[model samples]
Target: MAVLKPLGDAEMDERQRRMMDAMLVRGRDYNVFRTMLHHPAAMEAFLGWGSYILSDQNTLSVALRELAILRTGALRRCEYEFLRHAVIARQHGFTDEVLHAIAVGDRTPLTDEMAMVMKAVDELVVEGRIAPDTFERIRSTFGDHTAIDIVWTVGQYSQVCMFLLTAGVEPDPDVADDPLRPLFA
Candidate 1:
């Protein structure tokens, strides 16, 4: 069971009720939201902003965005984020082969643009700084605004991973790992 009890259907206020409805429609009975119910305002703003990014963001398609998100999750070893995004990744056209490769930080077959973005993510996460080469490559490929969006997107998901892990959020039960080892390991 989750350390924090979920907000039961009967317990939610109107705002939470709407968020819960959206979560259910997205097939996410999220343990994070359950825990965050302790601070409903934070949960409301956080989830609302998150929905906007996933649904209304510019600069990247759903597939590319989810790829960056899953990569950040895997790098952080945040099981909740990884598992949730792994499912969404597939829905957004990440083939099993590509998914497995990404789990291990292999960005093979990525477009030049994606590879540069992934390289920036890898450098930022692992080395605490984007390498000069990665910076140049991405800047050249994507221009200023797009490059900023890619980096910020990775940073945003990284923060989500940190929150989910530290807050003791549980992974969705419906998804399963294939080749990658369990993240919590």
Candidate 2:
């Protein structure tokens, strides 16, 4: 059960309602969003930054970004984050084989670039920073801007994983049958 009860439409004030409606327009009514509505101002602030991180404006490609997110969630054992990003990973064209590899921290058959990103995520989660060689490899391959985005992407999702776990957020019923559940279970 969620430590913070999610706010339903009928319970929202005008500002909250508007924010919820805006999210609905984007075809998402995620429990995270609904639950965060308990503090509308903070949710609004998060949405702005979150949008940028998930947007085309971010230096990382969607696939690379989602891969980092998935790995972070799995490492943290945040079931909600793992399952949610599993879906996003699929949408970004990650195959089941790749997803499973990420779930278990197996880099088999992945290109050097993919493996490096996963390594970076692990380093960040475990050491709070990527090693110098990994940092340089990422910078050279993806450029400094993308390297920074990679750090931000992993860091942002790491924070989200912590929030979801600490808050005891439940998985959205709509995704109750998420295939990734068994892998992380």
Top candidate on lDDT is 2
* Residue 77 C-alpha lDDT in model 1: 83
Estimated TM-score for each candidate: 0.83, 0.95
- Measured with C-alpha atoms, the lDDT of residue 28 in candidate 2 is 85
- Tens digits of per-residue lDDT for model 1 on 105-158? 777877666676677878878987788877777778767766666677787788
Report the number of backbone clashes for model 1.
0
* Model 2 steric clash pairs: none
Colliding residue pairs in candidate 1: none
User: What's model 1's TM-score?
Assistant: 0.83
Off by over 4 Å in 2: none
lDDT of 2: 0.88
lDDT of each: 0.73, 0.88
Flag regions of model 1 displaced more than 4 Å.
Answer: 10-15, 25-27, 176-184
Lowest-lDDT window of 10 residues in candidate 2? 176-185
- The RMSD (Cα, Å) of candidate 2 is 1.1
